[model samples]
Target: MSTTEQAVLFSCAQETQVGILSLPAEQAQVGVVIAVGGPQYRAGSHRQFVLLARRLATAGYAVLRFDYRGMGDSSGSARDFLDASPDIAAAINTLHEHAPEIRSTVIWGLCDAASAALLYLQDTKDTRVTGLCLLNPWVRSETSLARTQVKHYYIQRVMQRTFWTKLLSGQVAWGALKGLARNIRLSKAASPSRGAGDLPFQQRMANAWTDFDGRILLLLSGNDYTAKEFLEYADADTAWSKALKQARLERHDLANADHTFSNRLAQTTVENLTLDWLATTSNAIK
Candidate 1:
């Protein structure tokens, strides 16, 4: 299907946010809102977001890729993903306003943006958002990072011949061994206290995941450390492990893909997975 693209300005508090709306010749009832990750804008790394939006639009879904507060062409003070719920809520409202025919929506996000999507749902409980496409969500913490490094990095390195060669030749530094030891201790440390104090963002995310009745598509990139960390965290945390097994959730892994799915083949695979998942969600909605 042929698609049309245009720039849109929307309100998020006192600031005006910018977005690119991609509409197919025949719009579908379920629209897509692309929640951009921080330290990056709507164009994404190597224009991946732009390509994804266009492909989704070409497949007859109305797509919107936008800059939240303080990112891209938008004007505002900078904030982290934990504080992005308001911005995402605004974007979803804007999408609905632009496409009145849209009855429900799906949030498509990557990295911290994916975390923001769950946060948005947690904060607003917006019923219009019927699905989520999350790619390598951000659940980073000291323990999770240490555990992931020990498992994915240190363990893998120990199995390599080059590591043994360097150790036998006395080329391996003492600091490297100390760092490994520190990581080991951190990896085995107890989970943070959840008594009375404010709950951690990871717990909040898990709560949202468990409470949400909408369909979810989780995509992980095998070559990315961030993706590995997310898997490690999910498997380690009891709440997160249970949430991952929810009936409405689906998961896919791209073995050769990087954090952003920068290459054409990887990008195409992502688009295909998204399209297929969206179709299922749309059918269920009907």
Candidate 2:
């Protein structure tokens, strides 16, 4: 299908946010909003978001790739993913307005932006959002990071001949061993109590996941430590483990892909997976 692109401006927390809207030739009842991760913009790493939006548009899905609050062309002080709920909500509302036929929407996010998508659901139970496409979700806590490093890095290193060669030649720095020890200690330490005004972001994400009635597409990159951390965190946490086992969740692991699905083949796979999952989501609405 042919598609047209348009620049859009929306309001969020009294700030002007910028977005590029990709509209299919035909009217689409299901739209997709790309919630960009930080230290980046709508174009994404290696133009991933740009290509994704176009691919979805060609597949007859309207896509809106936008910069929330302080990122990209949006106006505001820099805010992390933890504070992106309002921005995501505003983008959804704007997309609905622009494409009035849209009855349901999916939020597509990578890295920390995936966490922000869950946080948005937690903060506002917006019925408009019917699906989520999360790529390598961020769950980087001290313990999670330590566990991921120990499991994916140190364990694999010990199994490699190169590691033994380095050790035998005294090429392995003492700091490397000390760092491993520190991570081990941190990994074994008990988590601190929360006496909060607000729940931790990870807990909030788990809450959203447990309560969400919609479908979820979880894409994990095997070569990314962030992806490993998310897996470790989910496996270790009761809330996350239970939530992940839900029937609504669909997961895929791209074994050779990096965090951003940077290569052409991996990017194409991501886009195809999204298109397929979106087809199911749109069908569910009908």
What are the lDDT figures for the candidates, one per model?
0.91, 0.91
Please provide, for model 1 over 30-58, each residue's C-alpha lDDT reduced to its tens digit, 9 standing for 90 to 100: 99999888688889999998999999999
Summing lDDT over every window of 10 consecutive residues in candidate 2, give the lowest-scoring window. 189-198
Could you tell me the TM-score of candidate 1? Answer: 0.97
Which clashing pairs does model 2 show?
none
lDDT of 2: 0.91
Which residue ranges in model 2 land beyond 4 Å of their true spot? 191-197
TM-scores for all predictions: 0.97, 0.96
The segments of candidate 1 whose C-alpha lies over 4 angstroms from its true place after superposition are: 168-170
Candidate 1 deviation (Cα RMSD): 1.2
Which candidate leads in TM-score? Answer: 1
lDDT of 2 at 91: 91
